[model samples]
Target: MPLSREKIAATAIRLADAHGLDGLSLRKIAKELGVGPMRLYDYVTNRSELLDLMVDVVYARIADVGQHSEWRSTVLTIAQATREAALEHEWFADLLGGRPHLGPHALAVGEANAAALSEAPAVRGIDDLQRALGALNAFIIGAVRREVTERRTARSAGTDEAAFQASLGPYLTGMLKTGRYPTIARLVIDGAHLNAEETFNHNLALVLDGITSRPRT
Candidate 1:
């Protein structure tokens, strides 16, 4: 088959899924595609371009939340969809927020998010919209990274989240006993350990609330 950008990006994504970004290279993708590495350069200019293409391939999977009557709902839908995509492509979290995504699919996703927030009643102007999107992006990226890290940790530990937590229970308990961190001790004693989805939704709502509640200037 003739080499194409799509083919190159797809092979790169598959390699990344298995070996992660560090394992991904033009040579590896070329090997996977049964072509010389130099041939890939014909399609992708360089490693950076390859990464951009890989990121866009993943972004293409995210469904548009579309414009909705309630801006919050639209924002929430977009956030959820993004999280889902990142979870599916664990490498996505590493690339996300690292640089601007100018690909068509990435721009479509951004456009949807911007449109939703722009129509928000509390959004005073461009500044408000920028801040709101910035906040959402920060939360989404952080949350996804945390979740992905935990997943990798759990897998590496050869245990589930509960087992891993249990393994840490002794050390954590001992640290909490220090009394130097009173609030943290209290949280250890009383805080609910929400699952990843619950934690994401709960925190996302809080973020959205903060954005809407900000005073219009």
Candidate 2:
């Protein structure tokens, strides 16, 4: 019997999550598995190959849509999956921007999104689908980046976002009381209902507003 690719990928993911991608190496993975460095190459040829496999391993978790029956739902689900991918490996976003067109995970995600968006009623041509996919990917990637960075920052500072924001909420409330920034105050006071889901929805709808608004033949 041979070492399973799943076992090798898991070791790499665990190592990347713990030490960041910068420190991830074949030797490190082998050390984690209690095997020689040469043993890893039997499953994956090199670090590049290992990265591709690792990416697909993460992407394999995404839900395969039968169709884009609900565009909003698909986008939101993918967005949430993006966040999950980033959180699963702290170094994911760090590796994301640079490893395009090469990693298995990277291409798998693109294929998934392209297939989903291509089925949308609003998509008219290949060009339309391509542009929409580009915009959607950009919007989602930005959302995940913002979330993971903020969460990492908050955690490193010994607090989570809610507690940190709560400390400032009172100050914001006082500013509202004195009317220093009346419009902002009003929004803040009323925006207390704004949670993560709501915020993401607001941004998602805003982006898709253009898509939904496009002249349909």
Candidate 3:
């Protein structure tokens, strides 16, 4: 049977995760699918279309997530899902710009997040959706970019995150301890043991705090 579009798009997503956006090409996809490069052209016109399809596939995974009564919960679900997607396809970091419009996955994820803001009692009216969606997209994108950038920098330094920090600890610690940046030093000392999960949770809570602590009257 000829491959369905869903099959093609799903394959593209796995390819993006395995090889990133740069390494993905019609030839590469064809190889993975056990076909000729021309076979892909039958379904997708070019590499850009493939990337768009791959992103939409990810959107499909999280599309049905945020439809409940609480808007904050919706955003949290979106935040986690987007982070997972970004980490899976670290190359997406380089490919997300210049979008003509949000694809299915991106739009579905946005709808989930928008559901969260929709539940907020104070965040009513038409413009509120825009504010909520903007805040959520910014937060998720920022979190993933910081995370991937740190991982890339660590790789460039020829070490993982913990080891890189250890290698630089002496100099950085000294600068902190000597009162160059006392607050930074204290947080580093106090936060040295916090893992990625803890860090993400903390950041999520901080964002939620900002949303919740606002003047609701």
Candidate 4:
């Protein structure tokens, strides 16, 4: 059968997951699909359009979270799902926010998030709902980008975070001795559990709290 846009996007997603965004290319995807590079043009005009399709495919995975009646829970669920998807496909972190996503699945996810937030009594108007949704999405994208960066750094260093920090212990100790960065030193010595999920949840709650605590005007 001739290749379809969905098939091309699926293959591109797999390539991105395995090789990261920097490794994705029309030629590479064509090679993986056993087709000439020109063949892909029939489905997607170019790499930019292909990326849009891939993003929609990823968004489709979380498009149903808006079905919940509780707005806060719906937002949290979608945020967590986005984080998990970013973890699975690190390339996704780079594409997000790079361009507008108007594909069906992307629109569906947006509609779900908007609908859930719109139902909240705390959300007073369209402006408030838009702000809340924007804040939630901004937080998720920023948090996931940092997480993906850290994970990539660890992978490059061939060690987990604790081990990676241990490797830097001597250097960090020397730097700390200067007492030039007291706050960072204090955090390094006194911070609680540095769990990614725990940290993500804590910060996510903080963002939600801000949204929910806002006085209705």
Query: Which candidate's TM-score is highest?
Result: 1
Question: For residues 105-131, could you state the per-residue lDDT of candidate 2 as single tens digits?
Answer: 556657666776766667889988888
The CA lDDT of each predicted structure is 0.87, 0.73, 0.72, 0.86
**Strongest candidate by lDDT:** 1
Q: Identify the superior model by TM-score, candidate 3 or candidate 4.
A: 4
lDDT of 4 by residue, 1-217 (tens): 4899989999999999988878999999999989899988888998899899999889988775546667778877988888888888889899787778899988888887888777766688889998988898898889999999988888899998678778888999899989999999998888764899989999999988888888866
Decide which is better by TM-score, 1 or 3. Answer: 1
Q: Candidate 4 local accuracy as lDDT?
A: 0.86
The local lDDT score (0 to 100) that residue 145 gets in candidate 4 is: 96
How close is each model in CA RMSD to the real structure?
A: 1.5, 3.7, 2.8, 1.6
TM-scores vs. true structure, each candidate: 0.94, 0.76, 0.82, 0.93
lDDT of 3 by residue, 74-107 (tens): 6677777667767777876555444743786677
Model 4: clashing residue pairs?
none
Error of 4 at 103 (Å): 0.9
Q: Rank the candidates by TM-score, best first.
A: 1, 4, 3, 2
